[model samples]
Target chain A: MLKYLFAAFLISICLIVGKALAHYIGFFPGSIYGMLLFAAILASNIFDEAAIGAAIAKIINIMPLVFLPVCVGVIQYGDLLQTSGWKIVAVGMSSTLSVMALVAFICAKILRDERCD
Target chain B: MNAVIEPIIFCICSIAIFFSWLQFHRKFPFALFNPLLLSVISVVLILFLLEIDYSRYMTGGEWISAFIEPGVVALGYPLYKQMHLISRLWRTLIGACCLASLCALTINVLFAKALGIDEWAIRSLATLNITTAIAMETSAEIGGSAALAAVAVMIAGFTGSAFGMLLMSVLKIKNMRAVGLAFGSASHALGAATIARTSMEASAYASTALILCAIVTAIVAPIYIPFLLSL
Candidate 1:
């Protein structure tokens, strides 16, 4: 659909702007910066969701697919993984669990006033 | 075959496997055969066995990559949709995110350092808690490998989604809010998806946590990581 393509076009424009801004600002990646910008625009109602509804739907459905290239890019770093795969996995897994426990405990402690039924 | 066409072939193969495996994944619902992970493995194995050069494979890889930025930019829509919920829990969510972000970065960095991991790898590890979209970019921005961070993000999401619920029960955390927050803040989309299967409220809360934690990390990591790495 034209709307789908249009939505992708709009996102591409945002991505360019985001990249340019990041180039100058030297902060987070342009992708995230652009996403925030798009979010702000959408929140402001400048771009009605209905106009781009189809695209938004597809984007949400296949977000993981978009990242496949990045994942596959790991093949280029095979040597690194072969040497330190276990360490990366160990560190990654531990930190994830620590975050889960820490956040769960903190949120529960804070929201203890309202109990779930 | 011409050089230009190799990328086209690569693209077709990668996308074919990805979509086909996705269908298989949905029917089977096995974590080990995650569509993304499986596709990557298939591509890697094919490329290795066939003696395909990384440079040529990237022809198609680069094509799909064009969509990645726009795909992430589209995240704004969901964030916008969840704005109401996000605002309602603003105070509590911010606190949890601050703590989560600080702890995620500090613990991962320090643990990796203790193991004497390369500094670049440690930098990539710092983006572990956020979604792959933000993590890959943040990794590169902070002088780490985007590729490595993507893999790390998937690993974090897979592990967290698989065990997060178990951890919550063991800790006696019955609050769905806490449970969802832990899943999203720690695991990203995969964790959010896992919780979504349990309840709507938890899923909503999980998405908010996922988006909020990502934004916080995107903003906080650059300023904080440089300082942390300096030490």
Candidate 2:
């Protein structure tokens, strides 16, 4: 219990500092900044990995639930979807397919060459 | 329906519905039966049936949404764990992810424009290939609706998880590294998770790609999205 609280506190502090930096820099989201800061701390060994592992695991386990409210906000945009749902779906599917194809082909070619060498 | 308890009820209901769907999903293990997608549909249906205002549901819903930012920050731990792998193949990983991110943004923008999507939706679509949390943040940063961005991300994620492997096999992309990176870069976490069931090596690569592509897109979207919009 105490460990979970400590983990939360550490993450919150990182998030707060990250948001402040984002506000100052006027680019990139604070969450990403916080992510980078947290990673840096881990890399630097400022805290033991075991200390936050369980707490972070618990958080990640429920991560999908966290997006529920925001996704539900889609209900408010019914008009937008009604007007352009198919178009949006088309764009999403095509772009995803294209990107996947591009990355796969490129990696296959490059990595294959490296293996041959 | 009491105003004072409404928010709490909505929050609890959302949690219950999500966990219930999650259990079902675990047992069924079907790709299309995404717990989030199903839960959203269920909640939306209930709200519609009840004639509840979206805002009223949000009053409680925002409590769950509040955790999104922290959850994203917690993603750092997984990324950190993969640092050794990243350090070893940093060059290839970074290069592939950068290309993937830029290509995804540009293609999404072009397709949205061709489909005559509105400008705001185009911005939302710009981050479609990124994971949910980063995609929403990047979308909003670029003057798009975070909600719409979530919708777009779900679409992209679902499509990738469903068809990505088939598409790769059809394309003759058999390399595990390539397969992992492609799915991760294009489909984000959902794609990575789907790929995880097949090969542990590919799963690692997929995870690395997922995290790296997200970072790349978050950095590149702010500049590239606007530039694409202008064109």
Candidate 3:
């Protein structure tokens, strides 16, 4: 129980830093940057890997958990979508496909077959 | 109850829904059919049917948010293991990072213009490819709606995953590096997660894309966005 709380404690710190940094430094996604900060500390030897491994695993298990808050709101605002909603969806989805294709094409064309690896 | 538990409940429902989605993700393996998209759709449908105001859902949200920090911290290990690989692919990763953000930015705006979308929605859409945190900032920086962008980016990733798979088939992007980068750019961390399931090498390549894209998006998106608005 204490271990779980410890893991939660660490995550709270990251969120605080992430939220703060997003407001201040205007850098990467705050939570993500906060993660990067945690990453830096871990990688730099400030934190021990084995000690945190089990706790980290529990935390990672719940990482996908955060997407929930936003998903709920999309429902509340459903009526706001309108005719433009589907269009927005179409453009967003199609652009993703095209962007992927365009990127792959550009990379293949730019680099020789041999050096790509 | 309304004042204290609103955020907590909202959060729990969100995590519960996504957890089920990840389970489905195990079987599909196809980028386009990721369970996250379905999960989002399902959540919307349920909320619509049940007529939940979403505010009530927030009551339990804190229950889930407690994990956000540890999750980010845990990722350090993956980044650490793959740090050397990142050093080698620095140039390629950097290039893909730039190209990815620029393309996502341009396409959303230009397409919005052609479609007659509003100004608030325009800036919100700009950060669709970026992760939620940055999307929030991107929305604020461009004088758009963070709430809109946050929703937009999540949906964009879902749609991007679905359509991205189709494009991959058409383009026949058989190479792992290209495949990984394509996934990383269009989907962000979620894209990388899908790639990781495909193969270890593929995951490694995707991680490089993930790290590079995150850093690059951070530096460039905010700077480029305001200028794009000026134009």
Candidate 4:
């Protein structure tokens, strides 16, 4: 459908612009750069609010699908996981918990003030 | 050319991808096991076992990757709707980001060493609270284990939500924004996705979480790693 094509076309442009900016900035991932690009396009009135809205809708709808390629990458590296099963899980779980708790504590302290007035 | 005869394989792989993702959506979803991680690993193994090189595999995966463009492009809508929330909380966001990044990084370093884990192991453990891909890259950049980083990100999501909610109840925290940001920053995309599933407000927090986490990590990793390594 034309909608699909429009979606694809816009994404390609954004991604290209994103990749370019990321290259120039010398840090941050290209995709993150693209998100910034989309934000710029939205803010600058270069892309229609409606069109970008429609595109964003499609992207979120299909997010689960988009992750397909990387899912396979995990499987490819299964052996490393299998061999180091306990160690990876142990370390992964501990770090995840500690970091998550720490971040949560900071957020609760800093952002939880209910003072957005 | 022998290379030209690869669409047949690409076609088959795409179907596998479609199904695996579909199964992922129905079962574990993002809140549980990140199916994308599984899908990528499986595809890579398939290609390696079948003697298909990266180019050919990408030829197959690229067809699927086509969707990634539209998906990324389409992310603007939620962002658009959530613009108000972003504007009102910009200042607090800055403070929260800095605090979260420092506390997260410091606790990770100290506790990891206290456990007597190796530096490489700790390094891998360090970046796991981010999304798998970013975690992987963070892992690679610091010469840590990328898979370990992925697991770390997942663990953060799981425990962040479970304990984060419990702690909020005990602490009598009612500020939705803080709850969302906490879950998002610590848990990254997975936590964000979880909020998206639960409520629009939560989703906004998650979006902020994603942006803030990225900002903080990009800032913190460089400074933190050197300090930790030196110690």
Query: Which residue pairs clash within candidate 1?
Result: none
Error of 1 at B65 (Å): 0.9
* Chain B TM-score, one value per candidate, order as shown: 0.96, 0.97, 0.75, 0.72
**Model 4 off-target regions past 4 Å?**
A64-68, A74-84, A99-113, B1-16, B19-30, B37-59, B62-81, B109-125, B141-148, B161-164, B170-172, B196-199
Better of 2 and 4 by lDDT: 2
Return the TM-score for each candidate structure: 0.94, 0.96, 0.79, 0.76
Task: Write one digit per residue (lDDT tens) for candidate 1, span A42-108.
Answer: 7788777788967787777877777776677788888888988899999989999999999999898
What residue pairs are clashing in model 2? Answer: none
Off by over 4 Å in 1: A114-117
* Candidate number of the best TM-score: 2
Highest DockQ, which number? 2
RMSD of each: 2.0, 1.7, 3.8, 4.2
lDDT of 3 at A88: 77
Give the Cα lDDT of each candidate: 0.84, 0.89, 0.66, 0.62
Ranked by DockQ, the better of candidates 2 and 4 is 2
Candidate 2: deviation at residue A111, Å?
1.7
Backbone collision count in every prediction? 0, 0, 23, 22
What overall lDDT, based on C-alpha atoms, would model 3 receive against the true structure? Answer: 0.66
Model 3 scores a TM of 0.79
